[model samples]
Each structure stands twice: as structure tokens, then as C-alpha cells.
Target: MTAVQPKPTPVGETFDSLNPATDEVVGTYAVHTADEVRAAVERARGAALWWEGLGYAGRAERLQRWKGVLTRRLPQLCQAVRDETGKPLRDAQLESVLAIEHISWAAKHARKVLGRQRRSTGLLMANQAATVEYRPLGVVGVIGPWNYPVYTPLGSITYALAAGNAVVFKPSEYTPGVGKWLVDAFAEIVPEQPVLQLITGFGETGGALVGAGVDKIAFTGSTATGKKIMAAAANTLTPVVIEAGGKDPLLVDVDADLDAAADATVWGAFSNSGQTCIGVERAYVHERVYDDFVAKVVEKTKDVRAGSDAAAQYGPVTMPSQLGVIRRHIADAVERGGKALVGGVDSVDDRYAQPTVLVDVPEDAEAVREETFGPTVTIAKVRDMDEAIEKANATKYGLGSTVFSKTRGVELASRLRAGMTSINAPLSFAGIASLPFGGVGESGFGRIHGPEGLREFSRPKAVARQRFTAPITLTSFHRRASADPMVARLVTFLHGKR
Candidate 1:
């Protein structure tokens, strides 16, 4: 088995990022050392002060300029993403558009979401005036994933920049080219400060970033790695927002749209070659229409393919080591008496994995219990929605889920134990800028996107001012004898039971 540990590093060493489809070296980057990471963070720490000094309007102007640069060079960015990750050009472009949208949203909404506002000083503190706002937390370090080399990291980087924090980003070693491209693009627009810096390397470099004294770290990766990040960040007491793993589910109700459910399930399960943290890994269909749903899903999945060719719906698996995990999951499911309605164990090749759909997989099997992280999904029949919800909630992860119900969409979606759930659709929540995205439990905590995202890289600063002296003199040392009884009477008058 391929080792899951970080690639070995020597001082001042460099590595090559290869294209998964052809094993061709796409880009070469230095494997930055701990000292280099620390230097980057220190630079960002200084830049953070300057960035925050610009206030919201100035930063928004710069961010808009950066966004414009990214928009104009969209083709190059998309091509870089395609080279690093073996996703289709269209998929890269789609994520590019979404990343740009987030950049625009964060730039436009940061001032409104984090700006100071007058807060009511309740009757108890009538003489005091209160105001609250979010302030930047200095440098923010982001460790991004390779699957979404653009959108996922931008979700954190853009929001952090808009919130007035300078960022130090360490993109996945597998996608360093895309990372370099992003940093280079930002440089052309905001060349004044190292407000956004890039460090390229494997896991050791990422661990260094965690303890580089950055105020906060936004990490998107696996749960096991998230735990390690939390541990490293704990050394400096650096806060973290971890966007980790997800074995999200999709529920198909008896009254739902079968064709729509089939289409959504297929797309959500296999898109990005199932490299999405919020991708649907499990499907629970109501017993009333189980057979029909399975047939439709199998039919739809047959048309979806994974290859390096232009005609394929998806491309090769970016991480070659993941092929073993996909194979194991498929083998385990079939051995456990599960039926493969589509591709089977042998479908996983050296680089690409064709879509695989398994039915009647045991709940405790690895395919259902662990994160497959491949173009594979499991479908099961549930006697009722209650059974479906119970089975869905059985996993340790709760990231993103989907529900298709003609009448109970809201009801079923509300009951799902996930961070974001789409009703009658799949993965639609990721496109809506106003929605907060993240997860609970093994999927991880904290949020990115919308107002919550802006606040994620910030610390709330609350201010209270004395409008005038109070007659009651509750805070004064010089109090008359009757003052105690007067205060007691006031408290009784306001809070005591009638």
C-alpha cells in the first residue's frame, strides 16, 4: 500500500506536480521549510496590520481589482486547475466562476457583515451605549485541498482578505501550480504588501504553517489530518476552522420526483470523481419506489464516465494513491453481499475510476462506514423516512445532504443532521453565496461563505461607552443607606414575579 504520510523533505528541496492523466510534470515548486513558512507568516503578520488599516472600503477596492484580474485571466486559471487536477475544462471553469462569485460576494458583503453597529443597551444598563463589530485577526493561514484547488481555498482566502486579514496559503502539494497561479494573479493587482502569500510543499510544510504563529488557520482536508492540524495549532493556541470529510447522504421519498432524484443522485455522487467533501456517498430510497429509483439511477450512471478524453463527463483521479481505497471499498461491498448495479471492483484503473453503484451494502461495511473518496455510491431501501434518517445519521460525518420530496422537502431536510442540505436538488448549496458552508461531528466545525465566513477569520470587538452618569450610582463607591433598598426594590419591580 502507498504510504499516507507526508512526502520526505530535505532542506531547500523542490518537487514536481504531475498531471494525473498523463503523469507529465506540470509544474515544479520548492518544498518550503518550516523557517520559510514562519517567514511567510511573519510577513503576513505585518501585512495584516496594513491591510486592516485600509479599512473595508480600501480593501474592497483592492479585492475587486484582484477579482477583475482573475476574471480576465480566467482561461489560464482554469487551465492550471485542469493541469493540476485531472478535472474537465468545463468543471474547472465552473469552479472558477464560483470562486469569482465568492470573491465578489465577500468583497461586497464584508463591510456590511463586519462593520460596527449600535447595539441596544437594555434597561439594566440604560446609561451605557454599546456597539459591536468584527475585527481582523491578523494573519490567517489556509491549507487547501486538491480536489477543488480553486473554489475551496478561495472560500477562505477571499473572505479572510475581505475581512482585513492578510493570508498565508499552502495549497495541496498536488496542485501547487494552481496555487502559484492564484498568488501570482493577486500579486499583479495588490503588489504593495505580501497580503497573500503562497507556500508549496507536502504535509510537513502544512504542519509548519499551523504553528507559524498565524492568528488563525482555515483548513480543508480529511478528518485525520484535521485532527493533526488542530493538535499543531494548539501548540500556539492558534484558532482553526476545519472543513473536513463528509459521507453525506441523499434521501429519496416515495412522493419525490424519480427522474429528478436519479439525475441529482448520479451527479452529486460522481461529480469531481467523488472527490467532494459534500458529495453524496449514500442514497436512501423509500421502499414504495425503491426498484424504480434503483433502475433509474443505474441507467443514468451508465451514461456518466470517467476518463482522460474530452468526451468524458469527469476525468481521472487526481491522487493516484486513492485508486487503492476505491478498489478496496468496492471489493469489500461486493464481498459483503452487495450488488454492483454499475461498474464493479475492476472498474478502478491506475488513474481513473469509472462510476460504481452498489446496492444492499451492509451499513457497517467500509464503503458505507468510511469515506470512499471515489466515484462510487451505495443505495439502500428504507421502510420509511424514519429508517432513512436513522441510517443516514449512523455515520460519523454530517457535512452536506440532499432530499427529494414533493411534500416533505422542508420537513426531511430539517431533520437531516448536516451542515447544508439541498431540497429537490444536489450540491446546489455550494453555489449560493448567502449560505454558510461547513459541517459538524467528524465532518468538522466552523463555517465559510456568507456572514459566518466573514466572521470566521475575525474576532468580535464590543465597545461600551458611558453616555452619562447614572442617578442610581450602581457602580459608585459612595452610596447612601437607602440606595441598597432602592436598588433591591428596582430589581424586584423589574424582575420579581408578580
Candidate 2:
């Protein structure tokens, strides 16, 4: 288990984490100031050296033990996740367990993927032995989101830890308790080091950490904020990984299982109040089965309710301002010739947003172009898979997409430009511990989870050792006329006949 750096010396008036469901105060935490951010980074710098010295096997053992701790305390973590984000207990549990899987996988696989390994030198340099290894990049600063707080940040944090880097995580203000809980648990196993640290506050605190000379920053937030983060990190030339918002699309083909597609759409769009980065915001169905698919989706959407009660499948918006965005998206869609098959603009309540499914929305409306980050999905009919692909790739964000087609699921999924595409499954790419998770364009760059996740937190270091001197030397002011011909001969021997 990674060490938890003790909370930085206290700062301004502390803030209370509010339960999004009812606005009740759940826990009180310090509003970490800029000075605290720098202090934490300094502590992490020390811890990282120790962690890196542990090497691959030592870190892997500690990580597996940490996974054991998480598995044993799964319920406690899930409750914290639910209280902070207003997502259902089942969904929270699922995310917590999935995070455990990633922790286990990253620890078990990091040595193979990131440890020093020999590489063959090209023909020109065959006399030298070459090797490549990934080295920890000191302290890593992770700015996590309120939505899927446990799973999303852990995706970056676990990988970073497995790669032997100490972490300073600044979870979204809305879900700080969950962050504190995780840090505290890890502290039990690693008391000697400050390997995993938490600094709680709002946007300014996050910005402070980004510029605090950390080797890298892993941020999951809005694209607008991502741009701001990029600009901030640029000041110090700090590398960053941004998992920005997405308007992911779910495509259904003529031969798709309408029942399954409908079920996935309802859950994917409405889960976590549709606050997920990889959630299905748009559904493009082939014309052959459009009516059936829409009907099934409406039926499923009716059964899911958003509320503060235990029975509710969906929950309130974690951030209050997000309610206004949800309301506007529904209103704009309705105003622009879109028909509400179930919910409408008035569905946005003070706390909970009723499931809203808008059909016939214009392609250019905010609901389609911008991220609706709520439990609302727009359904459209396309002539064929080609048209579906076109509409799916139309958005600027390419984070994740879903395809449901018996014969063409794999083929069509390959065409989408997103980082991950799930065939017949919603967000399945995130669950597969080996696949990379992230996106391109406005959805942001850098990957988390899988081999890519471990590599993201590290810098490649290449080492070349001379085994035997070449017959024709060429480095010094010595004779190299013969060496040039020898190099040409090697290149021709390797590639001329190919």
C-alpha cells in the first residue's frame, strides 16, 4: 500500500463536503492553499525516490496488499462514493470493485510492461547492446472529477503508483471525502513514506498543484478547463494527461439486439445522472429497427427514476450549476423541433433530474454538439452503418463509443475515432484492464489503464552498452571512409531485397 502524506499544515476556514442528494453536510475538510500544495509536492518528491527504489516486484507486492485493503473495505468506499456523487449503491459498488481489478492488474503487469528490457539494435548499430526502461517521473499530480470519483482518478493513481511515482491527488471539491478516505486507508500499510497525498480545495487549488513542479499532471474534467490546465502546466513545462468531457455516441445496426441496445442506452445515459465521461449521450439507430429501438428505450427509461431514495437508479446532479446546463439542453432541444418521448425541460428539479429522452433533435443543437452531462439522450435514425459512423464521429470529442450489431459490431467500432469502442457493451473498454482508456481532439490526450496507463506516468530511458567495437569506427576524427561503405552495405542487406 502507498503511504499517505499527512495533511498539509492547516489553511483557511475549512469547508464541508455536501451530499448532492439533499445538500446535507457529509464531512468537513481543509481548503488547501497554494503553500500546502507546494509542501505536499515536496513531500511526494521524497516518497517517490523511496518508491522508485523498491523496484517492480516490491511495488507490486505493496499494490496487491492495497488491493486487498480496498476489497475488504469495498462497502465503506462505495458508500462514500454514493454519498458524494448521488449515484446508486449498486453502481458505486461496481465502480469500486472495478477499481480493485485495475489495481490488481496494474501491479501484476507493471513489471513486464515498464521494467528494464533488452532491445535489438538496428543493423547499423548491431555491435552495441541496447535496452529500454521506463523510469518514474517523480511526483504526479492528479486532478480528479466528481463523477465516478473512485474509479476515474484511481485509473490514473493506481497506474502511477505501480510505476513507482508518488502522487498528490486533488479530487473534485464535491467528492473530497472519498479522496480522504482512500488516502487514510493506504496510510495504514505504508507508515514510513508519504507516497499518496491529498490536497483538497476548489479550482485554484487544482491550478496550484498543476504548476507546482510536479513531473506530470493527470486531470479529468471539462475540455474548457482542460485547455486552462494545459496552459497552466505549460508555464513549468510539466507534462499532463487530460481526460476531458465527451459526447459519446452509441450506434445500433439493423441486426442489433434491440432489447440489449435499449437496455444499455437507458443505463448508460442515465447512470450517475449521466455525468460519466464515457456515457452514451447520443444514439444513432439504423432505420430498419429505429422504431423498435426507440420504443424499448422509452420503456426502460420510464422504469428508472432519479431521486434521493435508495430505490432510485439515478441521482441528483453533484454540482448545482450542472442542473442549469441540463435544463438548457432539454429546453433547446425542445425549442428546435425535438420531441420529448418521455421527459422534457421541466424535468430538472432542485436536486434530481428525471430521465429525459429527446427525439427529433436537430443535429446542430447544443444537446448534440455540446456535452449534455445529464440523464438525457437524443435518438436519431440513420440510413446505414456508414451514416451511423459519420454521425458518431461528427463530434469534436472522441473519448468512447458503443456499437451494437451482430455482424458488424467489430467492423463499425474500428471506424470510430474514439480512444475506446465497446462492441455490444456500454463502457466495456474501461472494464477490460488491458485496453487503453482516453480520447483525442477536444476529449483530450494521454491514456490511463492498461500498459498505456503505466507508461503515462513514466519516462522512457534508453541505455546502450558496447559489446564489441565495430571493425570500421566512425565517431572520432579517425578514418571513417570504410565505415560509411560498411553502414551502406548493412542497410542494403536488411532492406534492399525486402
Best by TM-score: 1
- The lDDT of each candidate is 0.92, 0.90
Candidate 2, residues 110-180: lDDT per residue as tens digits?
A: 98999889998976777999999999999999999889888999999999999999999999888899999
lDDT of 2: 0.90
Q: After superposition, how far is residue 119 of candidate 1 from its true place, in Å?
A: 1.2
Report the C-alpha lDDT of model 1 over 33-83, residue by residue, as the tens digit: 999999999898889899999989999998899889999999999999988
What's each prediction's TM-score?
0.97, 0.96
State the displacement of the C-alpha of residue 295, model 2, in Å, after optimal TM-score superposition. 0.8
TM-score of 2: 0.96
In model 1, where is the ten-residue run with the lowest total lDDT?
Answer: 1-10
Cα misplacement distance, residue 120 of candidate 1 (Å): 1.5
